[model samples]
Target: MAGEITETGELYSPYVGLVYMFNLIVGTGALTMPKAFATAGWLVSLFLLVFLGFMSFVTTTFVVEAMAAANAQLRWKGMESRQEEDDDNSSTASDSDSLLQDNYERAEKRPILSVQRRGSPNLFEITNRVEMGQMASMFFNKVGVNLFYFCIIVYLYGDLAIYAAAVPFSLMQVSCATGNDSCGVEADTKYNDTDLCWGPLRRVDAYRIYLAVFTLLLGPFTFFDVQKTKYLQILTSLMRWIAFAIMIVLALVRIGRGHGEGHPPLASLSGVRNLFGVCVYSFMCQHSLPSLITPVSSKRHLTRLVFLDYVLILAFYGLLSFTAIFSFRGDSLLDMYTLNFASCDIVGVAAVRFFLGLFPVFTISTNFPIIAVTLRNNWKTLFHREGGTYPWVVDRVVFPTITLLPPVLVAFCTHDLESLVGITGAYAGTGIQYVIPAFLVYHCRKDSQLAFGPGAVNKHRSPFHHTFWVGFVLLWAFSCFFFVTANIVLSETRL
Candidate 1:
């Protein structure tokens, strides 16, 4: 009974949904967070992480409410279609009388604003999937929908770029550790691109080689339908948990044995810009909420489940980041946290080092194709027209080529994962995590009230239903843009 299949998708218990949300929110961004935290200073990072987590939670609730509203809109439209069908069908006088009597009885049983149940879920029950793009179309005007697509497209591009860079970066770091060559290197020594990887081959060149290999191997999937199999999902999730657990335990042991090397400052403004962005990126799941929320069998405690999930994610991120900062110096930290354990001096076992070094390669390699295909599909959707079909080349080649090239080029140009993450999260992430939800909830509220009237209630209405909260979210998004841009300007000026 707990697991039911609908036309849209299979349903799971709310607890499973909670786990999915947690997994979605704590991906690559969490790994990049400790360095940002260390650079920004513990005190500042702590305050910002907590505040961003709360803000993310609020926006998540907004998205949930918007989901309910989207469902209601779909249901309302379905009713209208059915009504038209009924009106078209001729009936005998007695049948017409029976229909009128039934309508009157239902009206007497419910309020004027209430919709008649036709053996379907309640109007506001989220039993169907409403993709963010669909919701945007329902709630926003043309300009707004275009802006929504642009923001999300940019975010996905950044995601692909990050994945493209990270896999190669991890491979380079691991491949560089051969025989006895890098064993003598100090733990705090930051290798430059010019550094030797194998004999005369430069690290940067090695990175490019791996990048080419990664592209050649996984790039073709963008042109075709590829999905993460259940087994693959399970494998990646297991690796993720094992990798994080190993890092945390090693950090704790390092601190316990009196070999701790980190001493972060109380506060620092220089790192705040990146930290803010990283925090925002780490907490991002709003864009994918529909896919996650619609499958839940019971949404009675959905908000509560979401709140609990956020709390767990926050605590896990804190544990990972805090342990990392105290266990390693800020300068010694790698953009990929797992790479920090790629040395024998840290993990002491060659196999463990190799596993930690290549973990991102394994996990990210699987995800890159999925994201690329998604981006390609989005491009197709963006330009798609009513009653029009694309040419074979445009359908098959053009979209995939455009989707796969830019991010790969970006990855080719630079592999500065920190800057990639910072800029991506600060701008595109803000639009997704903050701006989109605020507007969606606000617009959806207005539309729902207009369609269903004031007395109609949305069972999944956000706790922060006041107009002030919506305004606050939009104001905060704008403030983030201003803050990040100013910081970039100041940093450039100083340089």
Candidate 2:
């Protein structure tokens, strides 16, 4: 059964919807792209990034189509319930039996509404809000629904781990005294975690301390509801734009001054595996579409809006990655691109340097709590039983504790942002982005065919509606899993 629509907030225009989607898709993932591009070479990264962008867009449409189908199913069931109620009322009223019979005959002749034919499709109406979880329950068999939730849970865990590591790593970079103190130093210099921080603590020890501090501050918020206020979103978005623009402009200036030192290869087959994962991670938005799309007042041009957004995003990624690979040597490029500008010489002004240094710290800090709460809720939903209630301890303490601990522990073990992003995106991210949407759209199409017969058509059907597209997505997903698995196995053996 579809759950009750819980998001009853103010509706927004399509323009706002576009911005929301842009912000959601272009988050922490983009910070790690420049490094991946550097490792994989510019030509190969460019081709793979573009191809992945197209594939992600195709699946996004699949998700929107599934949402419309879920809404139609809910509307059909409600209509059936009302029809049954009318029949019962008509039978019970003995005093007006003749009148009821005449009205019933008229109804039979005209059929309450022509569109309400017993098996006709209700494709045009978009009234209900069916979440991804609800849509899974509606269309997926028992095993499919369970797997969907499992995939989502794993994806969210990765998201939290990335966030957990990012915030502390950024803090360490800014607060510690390190080599390459000036941006004009050798482009290939390396910094190790064993280097000293402030007084006695090594950089790695400081990182652990910061992680503990981060967990203490943000962990409690998971137990409570997190309402991301409008003003806070705007502020963070403003900071994000400023940070990105500064990175691009700084890279352009450095490259223009004949300081360009990168010599990336034409293609590096070894790096392609990790690059694919990073690109896939960057284009993720399917899981959050229900919450994002429901509040938009105008959806007639949603497809067009999504197309424009993707085009803009692709161009932005190309610009950012191209400049970074040219301006800095491949080995020197930081996992988080903003740190490349943290040095005083590259960004002369101390204020600008500070802003760029702390950019991720500011923006991702806000998102950490929100994601933690979402993960907690998904845990509850996964184990929840109908007409059953959890004990106070499990509801308040156990769920929150489990939700907060795993990712924190993962962050403590290592701060390798590239590997973290690569693994998460390649595995759980693939299931959430490619496999699930393909199956949801395929099943939704089949269910509609059975319910409304051959003549029925979904008004919101994906442009890539052929069954071959679904197979292609699944095939791509399988191939990715195989390649990543093989790479891991070979690397382990070599070690």
Candidate 3:
């Protein structure tokens, strides 16, 4: 059961792999981008979004290279183990004396087995299933591996908080009776906790109720194993495409009809902080590359496929954000863009309005449980001792309780999805996407050089293989953190 849960059988072509990556990167973050674009101004948003996308693609290549190197090392170790077993079986009394000498020589040469390979193509075989955790163990020191897990855990926590808030927020938007039902109505009427919902309960109270209901329904799944089947992915991808297409076309039509009310600025330094976070969040697929890339039938053009995927995603985000900023005033765009179409004036048909409004509900609901289960597993891995079994209470109760609580409590406190995404993407997201990959590739290259020698070539190395690229990424990550921190300090001082 554990093996089945962990292993995703290789069942996809390079094209399918591209699509899967595209879907993975362009999730909830993309939905919130238009508002960020409007706030940062279109020009700054465009430059930053493109730049961030390029950086994300670079790190993606880095991860892929590390994965290949990991596979090579694992293969080398397996062959060495088999040879040792054979030697043990075939040893004779006469050979015992020579065996000691051979052992000394082997002890000297064993480290080389990981880096130096004979002239066999099989030595560089890419069939191993080296997950990020396993690769961290292989390449990173104990501290680095723990840091990697910690970064991932924090990012996943942010994901859960965003998901928890988004679903309930969407529900409140569509089901609550108080909001205007017509599209392009008054744009400034922000609903508050005091706003009535369903006769007696206020909107904030309704939101909490939804959060509790959400926890009750999906929280239990965290205690047990869960896998997202191919069919589930296909269904969600289908819904995503349909919803996005409707939005883009609807916004374009509205603009063509001269109904566009938005005049976004060309640049806004004040909004750059959140915009940075949103773009970082949108281009996040680095942490999931192992599951995404490993199943490809052929990876000769894996880099090209990933590049194309990012290109499409960048184009999609640009189109979505551009249309949104043009079609609606900056203040009017919802955190979840699908809500924009959930009115009679924009979408006309009641069915379409409800479908678009509830899109987050459908998509995020499926994801919340999966993410919760993943967070639970990460906790187990973090404290797991070798040859040790966890107490049933710890396994089934404590981890799930911790996993389900913090994010839900966050959702309970506020449904500020934009700030949640911005902070998550800016900090933890930056670490996972930028800083960690830079270090991973840097160290992986050093390790490969030590194992395979300086002249050894890695087939999967990034096009930006120069050591300068690593420094550039780390430098950029530092600049971003510095800028965000300064912005926060400055904003609070002004307040």
For candidate 2, lDDT tens digit of each residue in 1-495?
122333545677788889999999999989999999988888999999999999999999999999988887787778779978876786676557776786778678886544446345455445567789999999999999999999999999999999999999988887773432434222354678998776788889988999999999988999889988989999999999989998899899988998877778778888887798889999999999988887777688888999999999999999999999988888888888888777655777878887888899999999999999988999999999999999999999999999999999999999999989999999999999999999999999888767666566677778999899999999999999999999999989989
Pairs in steric clash, model 2: none
| Best candidate (score: lDDT) | 1
Each candidate structure's TM-score, on Cα atoms with residue i matched to residue i, is 0.95, 0.94, 0.92
Regions of candidate 3 where Cα sits further than 4 Å from its true position:
1-8, 92-122, 177-189
* Model 3, span 1-495: residue lDDT tens: 112222457457788878888899989998999989999999999999999999999999988888878877777678779997877775653377787887787679776554345323455556667788888888889999899999999999999999999998988878773253434223434667787877787888888888888888888888788899879999999999999999999999999999888999999999999999999999998888887787777788888989999899999999999999999988888788888776666777777888888899999999988999989999999999999999989888999999999999899998988889999999999999998888888888888777667767777878999999999999999999999989989999999
TM-score quality measure for candidate 1: 0.95
Model 1 C-alpha lDDT per residue in residues 354-428, reported as the tens digit of each score = 788889999999999999999998898888899999999999999999999999999999998988999999999
Q: Return the lDDT, model 2, position 248.
A: 92
Question: Residue 132's C-alpha lDDT in candidate 3?
Answer: 84
Model 3 TM-score (2 dp): 0.92
Ranking by lDDT: 1, 2, 3
Per-residue lDDT of 406 in model 3? 93
In terms of TM-score, which candidate is stronger, 1 or 2? 1
